[model samples]
Target: MTSIYYIQVEDRNSMDGNRSNTLAGLKNNFAGEKEVLVFSNHATEITEKYAQSGVKTTIYQNDAYTIANFDAVLTKLKQIFRSKTDYLLVFDNDSLGSSLGSRIAALLDITFVADAKKITETPNLTVTQDIGATSAKRVIPLAKQAVITFSCNGVAANEPAKVDVSSWSLNEQTKQQYRQAKTAGNGLAFAKVVLAGGKGLGSQQQFKPLMKLAQKLNASVGATKAVTDLGWLSPERMIGISNLTVKPDVYYAFGISGAVQHTSGMNKSKQVIAVNTDPEAPIFKLANYGIVGDANKVISQLNDLL
Candidate 1:
């Protein structure tokens, strides 16, 4: 039977909801034959979560934290290559796991699918690519085995496996190497309520009211790349391509025109509300509710209602 592997950032202790989505998608599609392997710097926390979810197999790196040290990962990959499993699924953040899957496939002389949005097996192996707006699906004949990296938003969460934790070991040299190079800039991913502004806000000065509204709601403030480029807000606060991907419970778009790149990141939000002066802004198409009027005015009125 084929096995699925959910690879995540090692040093980061928190369980990735995105990984959860990928695993969920695999479960929905592959069902019982899948197993999750969590690779992490702090193995205890992540492995415990995996065990709770019933994934019996776990791998830990003694010193592997960042992608720079691929030794431990390579070792783990070699083990997977030896396993009887015919298919391996890898998940990554952005392009972090880009070349890892390809290298493993070459080592094992198996078919490789990089940045795949969807995967299915039939007469041949099929992979889907999510290339902005259009979905590209292709079929590849697998000569030996296959390794694939799932794209963001491609797969939903799978039902967690049922099992107890099993032991695995990592090299001490690799552990020491990672400890020396570890840095603190690795940021946290939060589930926030975001208030985002865009070019329609007119001027940088016009963004203050929006900020105040966000502050009132204790929400994180966000902006489109245009607003950030204009010095209206910091790049850290920007949402969309060249910015952060947020899946907040409530996402408020104040004056954002909703470019596809922008929407691609936040489209997963549970609730989306847009306030724009133009009734025909593309954002309205995705928003659950929309107010077609001056963003500043509508925001002020909503504040009063609050």
Candidate 2:
């Protein structure tokens, strides 16, 4: 029987519900054909969710919190692979999955796809990826055994559920190690709305209107690399590449050109609206609705609409 391994990240807060999305996608895609295995930190709440989604097997690790300890998790994965040559879908909790995915594939001597969005099986296994600035789609043919780092957008279709109780034990030493390494940070992923700015906003002074609009909506502020690079905004506010991935209920892009790197981080938003002067700006292509005009003017009108 073909098997599917869902690499569940222990740091759910950091992933911004990405784990849930990935698991849901797997369940929807595989359905009755394959067995689903969820590897997580054994958080009772999260584990129960996966189990309810029809995940037949669940593996819990004690020290799965930090990026430094991912190798230990990989070791256990190797053991699972030894028994069955399964197609492993490595769902990133953050960008950390990108670093560890290839290593896991190398260890198993299987081809690995980075940031893959879709997987299909015909006579051969086929994978699709969104790469480069154009969000170009590429396909790769794979043999039976392969590892894939799935994109969050591709897996957002699955809905998380509250599962019946099924517990697993972990080693005491690993549990102690994880507890000592836990870190604290903001929960930006759970934000209801995000007001993001870009270089097209003109100057640092222009950011005030965006901030004002964000405040009116009670949304957190986000920025593109251009604004951050110019030092007009802090790097922490940047939302692409090395920055945080967001999936807020609503994402407002002001003067952003919609570079692929920037779009990749927030494409999972429930609704995307872009305000830009350039009618052909790349960001407008992905937006659900767009207004081609001065951001300042649009913002002022938006304030009135709100």
Top-lDDT candidate index:
2
Worst 10 residues of 1 by lDDT: 180-189
Candidate whose TM-score is highest: 1
Question: Each prediction's Cα lDDT score?
Answer: 0.63, 0.65
- The CA lDDT at 187 in model 1 is 26
lDDT of 2 by residue, 189-302 (tens): 557678888898889998877764553454677889888899987677778877778999899998899999999989999999999998999998789999898888888776
Model 1, span 25-53: residue lDDT tens:
55555543566665665656445345434
TM-score of candidate 1 versus the correct structure, residues matched by position:
0.52
TM-score, candidate 2, is: 0.51
For candidate 1, the lDDT comes to 0.63
What TM-score do all the candidates reach, one by one? 0.52, 0.51
